[model samples]
Target: MNLTDATLILLLAERIHGTDEGVREAAKSVVKKIPRGKRDLIYNVINSPSPLELVRHVAQNLDT
Candidate 1:
């Protein structure tokens, strides 16, 4: 996935699991790799999805 999509996934995982220093750092790393202007887009995508869906999606992805 692109940086924006990756950031959204990380952010969603973090939100579902609650904030953690590691997760925040990881998300920051992803954001840093992208253009500053795109940060909001990542944030918007992360916040747009439901937490349950995020968790379920992650779990499903992992099972594969």
Candidate 2:
């Protein structure tokens, strides 16, 4: 299925907090592939009030 960038970003951020190291690494790989132009979106997610600490960490580290 073709996921929108926002959806993919949320999912990947969650996966980055997964217990499985491989899954976390794979999520990080995809996150880094996001266009730098999406940095604003990533920051928005990072700053959202309800976002988990791990999710915020992942979003903050996005190369986008």
Among these predicted structures, which one has the highest TM-score? 1
Q: Compared with the true structure, what per-residue lDDT tens digits does model 2 show for residues 1-64?
A: 1225654656565666544343344344444556666555444444455445445565577677
Q: What is candidate 1's lDDT per residue for 1-64, written digit by digit as tens? A: 4754764667565666664444444555565667766677445434544534443455467647
Report lDDT (Cα) of residue 2, candidate 2.
Answer: 21
lDDT score of residue 29 within candidate 2: 48
TM-score of each: 0.37, 0.33
Q: For candidate 1, what is the TM-score?
A: 0.37
- Model 1 segments more than 4 A misplaced: 1-3, 8-19, 41-64
Give the local distance difference test score of model 1: 0.54
Backbone clash numbers for all candidates listed:
0, 0
Ten residues in sequence with the least summed lDDT for candidate 2: 19-28
> Model 2 off-target regions past 4 Å?
1-6, 9-31, 52-64
